[model samples]
Target: MTVVSHREDRVQAARSQSSPARSRSRTGSWRPASGHVFVSGYVVLLALFGLVPALYSLYLAFTDASGKFSGVKNFTRSAKDYRFIPAVQHVAVYLVLWLVTLTIFVVLLALVVHRLTSRRTKAVLRFVYYVPGALAGASSVLLWLFVLDPAVSPVSKLLRWTGNDNFAQVIVPNHLPAVFTIIAFWTGAGGWIVVLYGALNTIPTELMEAARVDGANAVQTALRIQLPMLRKWIAYMLILSLAAGTQLFVEPQLVSQASFGIVGNDYSVNQLAYQYAFSQNDFNGSAAISIDLLIVALICAGFFVARGRLFETD
Candidate 1:
């Protein structure tokens, strides 16, 4: 009887050990419906804020300034508006500059930083890079306003080289595109570089080691191996930058405000819309400009979609 009791005790101990493992496995494997309640709330909010506003904008776009239905008149009027095309052109220049500079500088910097620095150093550099981005929007613009001021600027010599003796001269329409590009890069590229650096981390170490064995140098390895692996991330960044460029507002608006219209009023599509809606109280005209931009955004989105496979890995 005692022997049987001892055997039962051993069986109970084995069951206890196995039971916890089984429970853990079950718990680990089990996943509830993801974002169920969160997504439901999100959908409601999207319907209310996103869809409803979008529909109202579309409705307003088709109407005249006084809220009477006037099919396509607002759009046609915008087409003939002198500032319309210039706004588009300004944004185009800004986008081109932003995309080229952002991709080249961010990609190169990220790769070099990752390859040349230790992890701790990389972290510190990333934090430094992200500091300006933390300021963001109006605050960063305020800081740059000081930087562009010839009297107060640290780069006063550089500003004077542009022949810009005052704040107004610094933000001339001709220089706005380049100035905004630099500002955009300073405020935006840090975030992208951080993203690229993280993407670089996901690359398999074995591939890099193989390159090393094959006598590839750091630059060669980065360009030949790392760049290819970052195709998706680059594509993502380009799309995001394109979308953002189309919505150019805060920089130009702030520059115009702070510098007193030396940069002009109809500097960006968004500014043009704001001018109509708030300044002129022409909601229909504003909605029309907004719709035009919406169409442009949709076209851009389509372009990205058409090139979808370009971002995919082999």
Candidate 2:
């Protein structure tokens, strides 16, 4: 009878231990399932919004409107087009100008603002600077068009140095792009200044204080300490600016319209593509141009990723 009681007690203890183990196993399994569910949803959203469109565009780049595959014919044809080289050159020049302007003017302006004032004052200045960004694309281009005019513009005093009538014709073939670059910078640099200012604010205040205590001047601290700390932010800004530079459309497009055929219809790469697709009804050519732009954007993205500066710190 005692042996029977001992055996029953051992069985009960085993069951008690096994019960907790089983419960823990169930809980662990459930956590993985929940995680998998979340990952699945994320992948689905990415595929729908990102992957699918990208893949479709790729397909379009290789095919005609009738859905007949042409392999690399579209790409070759686009390259051979009369306007291709000039359009590429135009965009390249614009990119260089735009990126340089953004990097130099925006970063310098932000740093100056950071040094000169209190946080409240800086905030107000940033708002004032960013006001131009509020202007619609059409509005900005139209405003600049008027500003470039010798007869109508208040800045005609400055324009007269280059020949009032000749200067008013500034949007001529060779000089038009430089004018566009200046207009774009004036309208765009403010927002970037605000962005860099935010980055400047993230620098540790103690670092600045230490530098000051060590007898470092404000200029020394800004150039040596603050700028180095801002490397990642600056890299991010460069990538963004490069991407925006490649997407230059609205400025040239509106300028083309406002100039009344003075700025050629094919003045910009995007304008060339639009003329191909809408006026010429060449969807393949349009897709090819789009793919070319996409490749440039991808290269920029790849550069940021390869540098390990795209997202949060490694």
Pairs with backbone N, CA or C atoms under 3 Å apart (clashes), candidate 2: none
Best by lDDT: 1
The alpha-carbon deviation from the true structure for residue 107 of candidate 2, after best TM-score superposition, in angstroms, is 0.7
The TM-scores, one per candidate, come to 0.84, 0.81
* lDDT (tens digit, per residue) of candidate 2 on 50-156: 78977887888899889999898888888898988888888888887777777778878899899975878887889989999898877888888888888888888
CA-only RMSD, every prediction:
5.2, 7.2
Alpha carbon lDDT at 267, candidate 1: 89
Candidate 1's TM-score? 0.84
Give lDDT tens digits, candidate 1, residues 1-314. 99999999999989878778565667797444555875898899999997898899999999876778999998998778898899989998888888899989999989877986577888888998877788868888888889998999999998889788887787778888888988989998888989999999999999989999999999899879999788878878888788888889999888888766467777899999998888888888898888888788778766765564444447
- Worst 10 contiguous positions by lDDT, candidate 1: 304-313
